[model samples]
Target: MSYDAKVFNVMVASPGDVLAERALFREVIHEWNAVNSEVRKVVLMPVGWETHSSPEMGAGPQEIINQQVLHSCDLLVGIFWTRAGTPTTEYASGTIEEIEKHIAAGRLAMLYFSTTPAVLDDVDNEQYQTLRDFKASCRSRGLFESFDSLAEFRNKFSRQLQQKLNAHEMFKLTQTESSSNQPVSDFMRLTVPSLTHEAKVLLKEVSQDPHGRLTYVRYIGGAAMQSNAKSFLDSKERREVAKWENALQLLQEEELIVERGHKGEFFEITAKGYEVADTIIS
Candidate 1:
């Protein structure tokens, strides 16, 4: 098939220590492409110093990389595990320089710090300390993320990538045009949660009812709650049960659900409740 795809160059920046993460970058890009390429008609290409061929000397290594790769990326994904990397002429480290440069140009970057336990013997105290200092400086420079393991990093990055795509005007426009001729989705008007875990679970439970109603007693008692439910509202503790009661009342006041009967023995999911549930289930 002959087609044009919007191509975005993503620079993967890191020191020598995060080799596993560096590889994960490529895997994530490929995973994203597999799902998004045909649907979104967008291609994200990952670039790094290891993948680029430049003269051994002339300008500094980082400078050569800046000219050949980093400057051209549409997005930057920087990772740090232990080392802050080797110093450069104009900056403390090449990775830091790349990040600052990207930020200065008003581009996008996602910096991640791995908190997974490391062996004391394998760590260089000076470099680890430098990484910590660099992290502190980054607070005002741009937004960053912390991950405990590769699995968490993958999950977080996937969400972040989708969010970035949604926020891009061109991507939004493409999606609009693509679906303009189709019927609206059931999830078209859905509003995602701004409620507590307990409230969300209660709301979703009511939504799943065949008649759009649930017994108030069953709701608070945690009847048929999901295995992954996080709330402790069903516990015998009076304080926790009261918390769930408060959430239930709040939902009623918001018109997402309605309390029926003189004794408030039943609750019915409203149109608003269904809308919110679609956001979670879809």
Candidate 2:
């Protein structure tokens, strides 16, 4: 019943305005650990100033936090809404400071900005500008995700986290490789590069249909994959049609979808398929 696992500590960095999103990060991390820690032999420990650090003297408050919490984090998840965080002496805000230090240390980082509407009067003018500037600066460094709702945020984070761990060159395993001989390609099927936009479009549409089924029918002019009157096989040209049909094959190979009929005319999305769809769609 007992086992050993590598623990990856994650720091949740954000301003006070995104309190709901901050809590959501903790829930997602815990849920990931609960579902995947055993299978993957990795545990994600959520670390933040609130839960990870204790009071100490002899340093600036942010410095104390840096020593106590930020320095130890392996992955940094930064979320921003309206305002930037409270500024420290050396940086625009404590959250930014944490994010910068984490990146400087060569750790993996996932940053997100929320687009959900904010109250007109509550928006802090100066800090909002600061947040916008910071977000703009991030465009050059790498890609960051944006969400318009809490549900969207949850879906994106959960899905991307799977992408991160499924082929984890981002966070090198802290512990030495176990004798278990996991594999040369651990969950490589779920890697981002493998899912084309065509595949994503199909997965998203099929996951929402009744019984999660994708039906294949060959007509006089063309063949089609359909569900709820919507079509996945949208192309009639040979190459374009191959591309769309290949998306169906890739989904099946990943076990995100299963063939339900003997003639391979009906494909059904599995529970795993739905989870993967949730990650990719929203």
Candidate 3:
């Protein structure tokens, strides 16, 4: 018997900074295909400029990439962290140009912004500001997802893949059990609420601590959140202190960190917190 499967090209569009995270995006797709492709009669092929684009010189670099791969993209995933990308003749960056061209052609696009803190000294001021502006503009156009940790990124991508297949007509999933022989996944924490970037960073930092603790100490004129041999609070400024304080509170609210002794003073990372921290340590 012969079978048919529809293969959709998933174009990965991002600047150079997020190369590490970019691979994770493709890994998720490969996992999904391994699990459901045969049953669903659909396949997702991950495509990117790094893997697909070739050397040629007729037009600009971005234009060449567009002609080579962007024209045929079935789905566009635009990821941003520090740099927006090198500017083109028309758009903010090469990645943005790919996204704009793909979307303008009536294709689906998924955009994500990474919240992992970047060293301010190393970041290019112009490019970084451009990325911020684009991130803000993106909200007005359509739906998008934000993530702070690699662990959270993987989970969100998996969940989003499932939801998209179920919703999109081109890749509509066959109505059936995900797998009959396999047991339910304990790792499916889809119900787990998302975390703010600040909270996630603090959680990671604390997880790296020898005691795995997040402590808030109030002094005569200042307060600070200390963990992993570092202090987040630098000055006696109220605004800076409040932001770190809120991050501590958020980690507690999410149950990722539990109070070790006194409330608000000593909170240790939970088992689940370590699980997440492991994936994002690099």
Q: Report the number of the highest-TM-score candidate.
A: 2
lDDT of 3 by residue, 1-282 (tens): 454567889999999998877988988788667655655566889998888999998789899889888988898888888999999999988888898889889999999888989899989999999999888888889998888876656556655666687778656433333333334455443424477677778888877775566778787878767888888888777877787788777877766787766545877665456555655634
**Residue pair clashes in candidate 1:** none
Assess candidate 3 and give its TM-score to the true structure: 0.61
Error of 1 at 246 (Å): 36
User: So what's the TM-score on candidate 1?
Assistant: 0.64
Return whichever of 2 and 3 wins on lDDT: 2
Q: Which ten residues in a row have the lowest lDDT in candidate 2?
A: 171-180
Q: For model 2, state the Cα shift of residue 122 in Å.
A: 0.4
Task: Give me the runs in candidate 1 sitting further than 4 Å from their true place.
Answer: 169-282
Instruction: Output the better candidate (2/3) by TM-score.
Output: 2
Scored against the true structure, residue 4 in model 2 reaches a CA lDDT of: 79
Global lDDT of each candidate: 0.73, 0.80, 0.77
TM-score of each: 0.64, 0.68, 0.61
**Which 10 consecutive residues of model 1 have the lowest summed lDDT?**
223-232
- Residue 33 in candidate 1 has what lDDT? 74
Error of 2 at 193 (Å): 24
lDDT (Cα) of model 1: 0.73
